[model samples]
Target: MTSTLVVIGHGMVGHRLADRLRELDTAHRWRVCVLGEEPEPAYDRVRLSAYLRNRSRAALSLVRPDFLADPRITVRSASPAVSVDRRARTVHTAGGEPITYDALVLATGSRPFVPPVPGRHLGNCFVQRTVEDIDALSAAARPGRPAVVIGGGLLGLEAAQGLQLLGMRPHLVESAPHLMPAQLDGEAARVLQDGAARLGLHLHCGTTVVSVDGGAGGLVRSVTLGDGSVVEADLVVFAAGIRPRDDLPVTPALPLAERGGYLTDAFCRTADDRIWAVGECAAVLGRCHGLVAPGYRMADSVACGLTGHHADPLDEMDDSTELKLLGVHVATFGSTSGDAGTAVEVTFQEGASRYAKVFLHRASGALLGGILAGETGSRADLAPWVGRRPTADLESVLFPAPPFRPLSP
Candidate 1:
């Protein structure tokens, strides 16, 4: 008898789980049903800013052509799971439909963390998450108008750049002393700041927004910083961070991690053997990973377990990231920082444009972690050497010789 597998949420990671299961279940032992809250199918959220340029939904879609045609897969868009009955093995949808399943997977991703501040509920304030949010922002953005983007991390920078592309003057605000504090150190952040400045992007670091003043018609007029200074703006975007979506009404109430997310074991399974959690909604082994790489790994692990394939538990997760922000290359891998007693730190700087730092084990030469800015050509080469010693010399790995150049005659 074939079993029914119900997957809640159809974001990237959720979609990936369904795809993996379809590939692994060659014997057709299970039927899959995916429930999504959004009306549109899963798209590449990491490149969401690209929508500001072309405004094409199909360009960002992750769905395969044959995916919807597969007889074994059923997809229900705009249908959010309202509650789960563990004892009955049933999932209740918002549309008053109950789905019975042999196995259930919760892939309900996350939501943007908007800070609790005065005047935050005013019009013109937005959070970048779904396609609908982007459409609203695009419709409100006007040329030469002042806009303020909260948070200087990856998402904030992307939001600021998107506003700039819409011909708005964007001012980035970050509570941290430097930009991307979670990934890049001060020096590397400085280099990235310089690059951003060259692109006409204004930045305000080391301060928090205390209040957002409203104008007529309940629209945003200006935002007050922690230092009693104010930045005039018509638009405000909060990209501070994300909180996992683990508030679904479960019959017995699923336990959450300290930081928030469905608590799961290394196998991505909850206390009940019939249910599992993946993606940002899952907190595996008391820790929640906010990146897509780890979420993909979690999805794979669960798919393998359900398909009766031997799979490794999700214990070691790779948090490495490499991307370009405002034309500046930035990459971080493994452990980027360590106290003086635990590890040795090596740094290299070339003027104000390039900075690189690597942490190595004190006793052995094994690579621990590293940060790269301005030039990240070496990221692909160094990613494989993360937890092990490099085959080549350290200098060669860090500062690879530039391509052979011929002298001008």
Candidate 2:
């Protein structure tokens, strides 16, 4: 009476689905099979930079030792699914093994987007994605040397920070006018830029890398900027963005979203009901959410659908994010952009290190979205009031009074 569920790509979100399924399937109604392309089991990629500090792989592992020991759950590491036979409901692996499944899920996740610039394929160029990538970067890092980090977003800043931790001077380059343009407003970005400068990070904003020049042995030497300037570099790390890995080979090609990723319904189901997708691989309603929270929600939805429970639609997936880069706290929730000019804005600032801005509905006082930079102590408290009006006064909500402290004797 039991059915088989095969999941491809044993990343964080993929493993969550298997774990959730086992938790809900108390009757042992389903057996799970996880296919991972990496030789090691799932690890915390979000904390990948931590590996640079401790040099411990086990510390980043997301899987518990005993979790995979269950007889109902089978894990095959270093086994990448090469193709899927939709008609036969079979997944073929690179090792020439075929897995049959009653229900199949794609959690292939995403790949780091590398921009096409000359010498990008040089030996010193790397992408910040996996532990192995970090290891490679650590091996190549030399103290006091200059390193160029492409992109100035969350991941790029993290990579730059990691390199700085490794004793390299990091020069961050971004095509955008300011850092973290996607997550921060202009004022917030300015605050972050000042903070970054204080941390000894050289930033190149509003410019693109025209080309990367390499020295002997095909190793990167320097990068040419669009403004006819060049920055010397011993290494370059790309953290521009990500694209979903939805191009997996299938007998009949699966439809893809316009922005890339397997097209899926709100329930994370593909055109074929038996096949589903979760995580970055699933493009629900023609949009792909790059954050892990939304991907976890998608995984839960698919698990519920497979278990005969009412699956929640992807409409409620929260894309809010909180981050700390080089000792600076930044948080963004809901719609931070008021470009359409339909919302009323509230702003507050204190010195060079603190800034907060919230957008409200023009007619209703309901929260539209907001950005917090420098001080994010209220992030957890403010997140829940994202779409709804706050019970407390707007001033108190935006700037909660500091916790009382006893005076020194």
RMSD of each: 3.7, 4.0
C-alpha root-mean-square deviation, candidate 1: 3.7
lDDT of 2 by residue, 1-409 (tens): 9899999999999998988888788789999999999999888899988889998989988888677888889999999999999999899999998999999999999999999999999998999899889989999999999999999998899999999999999999999999988888788898889889999999999999999999999999999999898999999999999999998997788899999999998889888888898999889988898989998899888888777778768876678888777778888888877754678777777667677788877776788888888764457767788678866565565556643221111
Whole-model lDDT, model 1: 0.90
lDDT of each: 0.90, 0.87
Model 2 pairs in collision: none
Candidate 2: Cα lDDT at 261: 92
Could you tell me how far off, in angstroms, the CA of residue 205 lies in candidate 2 after the best superposition?
0.2
TM-score of 1: 0.96
**Candidate 1 runs further than 4 Å off:** 401-409
lDDT of each residue in 262-376, candidate 1, tens digit only:
9999999998888999999999998888999999999999999989999898888888889989888899888876767767787777677677787877778778888888864
